[model samples]
Target: MIVSLIAAVSADGKIAQSAEQSSLDWTSREDTRFFISKTKEIGTVVMGRKTFGTIGKPLKDRRTIVMSSRTGIEGVEWTSEPPADLVARLEREGVTRMALCGGAAIYDAFLSVGLVDELFLTVEPVLFGDGVPLFRNGARINLKLLETTKLGDSSVLLHYLLLK
Candidate 1:
């Protein structure tokens, strides 16, 4: 599967102003529209529990998978499975593409496991000097730039492929 990590980050590399802050609160309308379109095109999205909590519900028309220890979510699938195992299972089930929509730890988990094939980051104009970062656990992956798109006058979408 083509696994990509998608996020809208601030100038200072922060994904949110707070743990509960939604990207919709800070990202541009263009970025939001791009995110929705890209994820829907991918057909599946995986995110950590806290990220899901911020959104407060399942995203329409996509398979929502929350990586949580607890299960039985009404509209989404909940799993505690490791990133690679989950990706492998999804590939076996014939999923061709997936998006890793994150709140830090989820990004770290997938990237650290070397399962992410690409990154789609929308860089917003603002900066949060102190806030939740894009990668909580830190990652050391090199990327080759694939594309750069102007989401708006102040927002840019950076697309990159992971270098193996």
Candidate 2:
């Protein structure tokens, strides 16, 4: 199974303004395009409860799974322990490639479990004075370079693979 962590962060690693969950509009246009393109390659996406709330519904043309303690949501599969178990369940459901989309907490969850096989990072050009971090607390995992690319005017794609 290929578990991917996909996100756009500022050059300094902040994902959004600390006080605002809705003010991530400055990440940049090219980066957004680049991110969509990156996500197109995956068949399923896993996100945190908050991230799913922000998106409002399941994404089109892909199998979407939201992780949380609540189990009965129509579109969500409950993900409680060893977050990797979520990935495994998804794989059982015919999802071979899954991307971890985030509001920070989910990204950290996937990272902590060493389930991330690739990281599709888009480095936006602007920096926020204060913002939510891309990750707060998570387990340590090592990585190996897979590939890198220059997307456009101000965005770069840093792709990596799990070391193991």
Candidate 3:
């Protein structure tokens, strides 16, 4: 299965101004529409518990998997499984692709494990100055540019393929 990381970030590389801050507050409507379209096409999304908390509910029309120690979420699947194991299981279950929707640590976890195949980043026009970054662990991962498109007058979407 193919795994991709998707996020809307500030020009300064921050994903959110605070833990509670939602992307809807800063991202353009074009970016939001693109994100929804892409994830729905992928059919499944996995994210960290904090990321899930920020969203407050399962995404409509997609399988929501929260990577957390806690269990029994009413509308989502909760798992503390490692990245590789989770990916393997999903592939076994016939999932063709999945998106890694994150709050930094989750992105780092899958990227560090070398599971991510692509990245879709929407860069907005604002600067957070200091906030949650796109990747918390700061690991070096190479990527080949695939495509770039203007999301709106003030934002750009960057697509890249992971270089293994």
Candidate 4:
């Protein structure tokens, strides 16, 4: 499976104001728009439990996979497996591609295991003095910038390929 991570971060590289806060609440409209459109194209989105809680339910017309130690979500799939096993399971299920929409830790898990094939990030204009970071416990991986484009008046979108 091709795993891609997508996130919108503050100028200081934070995804939220705090662990309790949601990036969707403060991220730019441009980033939201881009995220929605991209996720629609991808069709499958995998995120951590907290990330799923922020959204509160499965996204319409897409398969939502939540990574958690617990089991049994009614509408979406739940997994407690390691990132590599999860990716293998997804591949077995015939998923060609998936979006790793985040709450930081999930991003680190996938990236640390070297499963992320691509990363799309939107850099918003505002800064958070302290917040949840974009990635935690991640490895230092080489990235090849695929594209950089201005999203709005102050935001920018960066697309990168994780060098294998």
What are the per-residue Cα lDDT tens digits for candidate 4 across 1-164? 77889999888998898777777788888888899899989999999999888888898888899999996569999999999998888899899999999988899898888899999999998889888888777557899999999998999999999999
**Which is superior by lDDT, 1 or 2?**
1
Instruction: Give the alpha carbon lDDT tens digit for every residue of 45-83 in model 3.
Output: 999998888788999999999999887569999999999
- Provide the lDDT at 91 for model 4: 90
Evaluate model 3: give its lDDT: 0.91
TM-score (C-alpha) between model 2 and the true structure: 0.83
RMSD of each: 1.1, 2.5, 1.0, 1.3
30-119 in candidate 1: lDDT tens per residue? 998999999999999999999898887899999999999997569999999999899889989999999999978899888887888999
Task: State in Å the error of residue 132, model 3.
Answer: 0.8
- Against the reference, the lDDT scores of all candidates come to 0.91, 0.73, 0.91, 0.89
TM-score of predicted model 3?
Answer: 0.96
Ten-residue segment with the worst summed lDDT in candidate 4? 131-140
Candidates ranked by lDDT: 3, 1, 4, 2
What digit string (tens of lDDT, one per residue) describes model 2 on residues 66-137?
778776457555566567666666668787788788868888777766677888778778777677787677
TM-score of each: 0.96, 0.83, 0.96, 0.94
Q: Give the range of the ten consecutive residues with the poorest summed lDDT in model 2.
A: 18-27
